[model samples]
Structure formats: C-alpha cells, structure tokens
Target: MEHPHPMKDFLVRAADLPWVPQGSSNVWFKPLRISPATGSWVNLLKVAKSGVVNRHRHLAEVEGWVVQGHWHYLEHDWQAEPGAYVYEPPGDVHTLVADVDDPDHPMLTLFSIHGPIEYMDETGEVAYVETAETKLRRYHDYCREQGIAPHEIVF
Candidate 1:
C-alpha cells in the first residue's frame, strides 16, 4: 500500500517547472526526466516565434507529442499539431521549425530522446552536440541559479 521509493513517484505541475533558455531567442526547455545510465531524457520544448529551431540528427530514436500549437520539419511536408505524436528514427536529420503565427500562444511539445543530437549549421556542418550530460548540466545550473535543488526539479 505504501511505495518504498517515494522519490520515484514523479508528479509536478507543468506550470511550476522553470523553463530554461535553450541558447536561442524564443526557445526554452523544461527537462522532465533524465536517466544518466541510459543517456535518455524527457523534456518540454517551447518555441515562441516562427523560425528555424535547429537542424540535428539523432543517434538514437526520438519521440514527441505536441502539447500546444504546431510545428514541422522543413525537410518534411508533414506538420505536427496539438495531440499529434511524432517519431524520429535513428539517424534522421531535419530542421525543426515552429509555427508561431499566433504570437499569443507558443508551440509546446514533450520529447523523449534516447541519445545525443548532433546540431548542424546551414552548410550541414556539425556545429554542436547535445546529450543527456549536457542537459543535466543545464538543469543543475538553472536550479542553482533559481535557488531550487536539482532533485526538486529533476527525477
């Protein structure tokens, strides 16, 4: 009747989670879950303006669910709106862009990523890389700046 590992029970109001700038204007992310062992993570990505977010290739499969507004990849014709579930297979490369015609409401999506994302530039050069360790570092930095414990924000 009682759970042994209370910390394992994850529950938090989405609004209460702090959103950290993803080194880009109008782009923010709130990490939900992170697993160091598997290098996997779940995060909420928010984009407030219509523009190119990034061009990245995943080393492992990635999954996402649109929570609000819409977005799509420039390389793909399909669009993801609220309630849409998307899957990106390993080695998939695409440019993520947000549809922010409605400035009042931004696009938000929940993403579960299983490996590092290799960000590319317009020339298809590897500009940078983002992995679970980087995300964890960012999360810890954000929590430290906000005066909140890391355990309080991440599971």
Candidate 2:
C-alpha cells in the first residue's frame, strides 16, 4: 500500500537547538520531533543534578535511549546508563531522577513518547498534564524567545 504523504526526513542537532527548562532548574529538554495526529514526539531530556525530575504516568508506551550519564526511577532499582535503552509500558507510574555522581557532566537521554504524561504529586495525586500540543507550544515559545526561526528546529 502507498502512503498519502511523502515521508519526511529531518535532522536536529542537539547543539543547534535551545534547551527548554522542564519545570525545574536542573531538568531541561530539547524537542526533536512532534506529531499532532497521533500525539507522538521525540525529545532529548537533560538533567544537571541528582534529583527527581517528575512523578508521572504514561497513557501510552514510551521508549528512551540514554545518551550520556545515567538516571533511575524511584520505583525501580535498575539504573539506565549511557547506551542503555529503556521502555515504559502504558499506565506505569514512576519518578525519574538523575544519577549525578559527578556534577561536571549532566545526564542526557533521547525519549520517544507516544502520548500525554500525567504529572503526579508525591502523594500520588494528579498535579498537571503535559500533552503534545503543550510541548509544541513550549518549543515555539522557546525558539521565539531565542530569536530562532521555528523552521530551524521544528518541522
């Protein structure tokens, strides 16, 4: 079967994109790709300190690859280090924290998310939610603030 739209090939250099803060001083993200149709996206998550990034549950499956340094989930004992590929099943809840033994270098991971993430409080109560639209808005806002043309990073 043939596809309706031509496949698009794009490139995003981490060094070329601006790092947007992700609700914390130590945690940041660089959006790589966003799909409005399916609410899917890819991003680079960076953490500069050994601290909790968030407590969240995914509505869809999530996949990630550790690019540099390491991180672990509070609910799990296994650590995701450089070159490690991690997977999160739908509806699984966990708190992401950086394993920053050396502050000089931060942890970097590439994540492919399929759905919205429901951010939760320490008591397991819903705090806020992050969706594909919200992420796209953030990316646009960051690019505008930095005087970076949206086309330069977003496709």
Task: Report the number of the highest-lDDT candidate.
Answer: 1
Q: For candidate 1, what is the lDDT? A: 0.89
Q: Which residue window of length 10 is worst by lDDT in model 2?
A: 146-155
TM-score of each prediction? 0.88, 0.92
Model 2 stretches with alpha carbons more than 4 Å out: 152-155
Model 1 agreement with the true structure over 67-150: per-residue lDDT tens digits: 999999989999999999999999999999999888789999999999999999889999999988899899889889989866
**CA lDDT of each candidate?**
0.89, 0.88
lDDT of 2 by residue, 1-155 (tens): 88898667887777777889889899899888888777988999989988997789999999999999988999998999999999999999999989887878899999999999999987989899888889999889877888887644344
| Candidate 1 runs further than 4 Å off | 1-7, 153-155
Error of 1 at 108 (Å): 0.5
RMSD of each predicted structure: 3.0, 1.6
Worst 10 residues of 1 by lDDT: 5-14
